[model samples]
Target: MPSRQKKVIFCIAGLLSFGCALSVAVAIGTQFWVKGTILCKTGAQLVNATGPELDKFVGEISYGLFHGQRVKQCGLGGRPFQFSFFPDLLEAIPASIHVSVILFSAVVIIFSLVAAAFFMYNAFGNPYETLHGPLGLYLWNFISCSCGCLVMILFASEVKLHRLSEKIANYKEGNFVYKTHSEEFDRSFWIILFCFTVHFLNILLIRVSGIQFPFQESKETDTSTGAADLMY
Candidate 1:
């Protein structure tokens, strides 16, 4: 490929990285805000004061219901506990909304990398299953390419489910029901990793694909060596 074409390809990869990272940052940041403490406290207070029966209904629609996944995880892991997954899934709606945003970002990342791989494959003219050479490069691009989203599915499933686990009830304090801080951050890190992985792979394809992987041609073709032979 011509130098100008390569430059354009690199620029596009840069744009993809920036867009995906910015999106992941915004989605994760905005999530907890809508499910803020005041909302939880208000629901809990209503449940405690007037009627426990009302609490069930309020919890069903609110973030409190999301904790069922956490309880279920523990139960599945041989921890003896009982909780309804239905309400947990219900409370998880806020997180479900947030995860949809993450999925959107993942989709973008996958497309960006696929474009990069296509560029590299054509530019270098390397065979798809390049034998005995530079397997890492192929693996690198594959992770961010079309296949990356399927890899992301595992993380998405675990984290999205964990979102439901964030809900748990604690003893009431004065006018408010107690708050137990959630674990949304843990899952968020993985989402960020996926975004970064996309950027990393795309950048690697842009920078490295032009050069033969696991092989260097510089020394054999040195210009100085040819000039010295003429002088001798």
Candidate 2:
């Protein structure tokens, strides 16, 4: 590609990286990561609620990394409660896995910013051939993508394998046992997935900007050098 075309491609990738950074940041602070309903098992059993009658004993739950809100129901009515993860519910939940998810999310945001900066530098400035150059762009983007994937995987495990919703629903309940009726990842979780996709796309954009993959570039240079030596 021509120099002008390469600059444009780099600029586009930079914008995308910046966008991913902002999107993930917003998602992390939101309480829409997981949304579900919890059924009051004790109340339902006591009343032997069947069919639509079960709805009276079911309530909504939604949460994110930091804090969340849930509506509790036990055949009486819905009672709203708010919660936090840091010091409050840490014992009731998988603190290690939850913290790991948050850590990877922060990593994704930081590396995304780094990738965006590098993309802009590659587009408009003369960067060093080492960490500040095209290879660095690939490294940063790949890190961001990998971290995004980790965020999703770790969170999914925390929710599913660890039974996060049930734990939260029955956190302080003494007489009632709550069971998860339904659970699904919400928009905030999907935003991380979108960020992962954007970083992957940025990798392809780097290639489209006429930069060869690192190993391929080195192999081709070696082949050319060998051919020149043979001719000499």
Candidate 3:
């Protein structure tokens, strides 16, 4: 590849990495990872609240990794109450799984930043053999891709397969009772997924910048050797 093309590719990859890191950080901090409505199962039945009256029995819930808000419709025109995950709802499975998700997201962000640094160094600076060469680009991008994929898969499994929203809503304490009416992974979840896709696309960008795939080159070399021996 031409020097100009390589520079362009590196710049694009670096910008993408920065975007992914920023998005993951925002997702971690925002209390919008999941959003849904919860119903006061016991209170609704007791008051026979149905139809539009059921709106009075409905509550909105939105949460992230650390803290969230729950607005109860039954009281004070749906006043929102804040809650934290640790020490308050640590016993819940969703909370535990989300803790793992947050950890993996951090890993993804770190790896992405590292990859971006490598891209910039290779583009402009004098790249050394191991950490700033083509091999370094492949290694860093691979790690970033793997970490991003793990973040997406683990969080998706927790939300979809494990029924995270329902579990959190069903958690009870003393006289308080809540049941999940409907739940969905919100913007943060999709943003994380977009980050994953971007990292994966970076892998393709690395190849497009004239770096040969490592295993493919090895296979080609072995095949050439075999053909030469047969000729002999």
Name the best candidate (by TM-score): 2
lDDT of 3 by residue, 158-227 (tens): 8778876666666664565777888888899888878878878888998998887777867988999999
Kindly list the per-residue Cα lDDT of model 1 for residues 57-142, writing each as its tens digit. 22211222112212111111312233443443334244454445446455655554444455545445544544312443444454
Instruction: Order the candidates by lDDT, highest first.
Output: 2, 3, 1
Model 2 segments more than 4 A misplaced: 228-232
Candidate 1 Cα misplacement greater than 4 A, ranges? 32-197, 200-204, 207-209, 213-232
| Model 1, global lDDT | 0.43
TM-score of 1: 0.32
- TM-score of every model versus the real structure: 0.32, 0.97, 0.87
Question: For each candidate, how many residue pairs have backbone atoms clashing (under 3 Å)?
Answer: 2, 0, 0
Give the lDDT of residue 81 in candidate 3. Answer: 81
lDDT of 2 by residue, 1-95 (tens): 99899989999999999999999999999999999999999999998999999999999999999999999999889999999998999889999
Name the candidate, 1 or 3, with the larger TM-score value: 3
How does model 3 score by TM-score? 0.87
| lDDT score at residue 11, model 3, on the 0-100 scale | 91
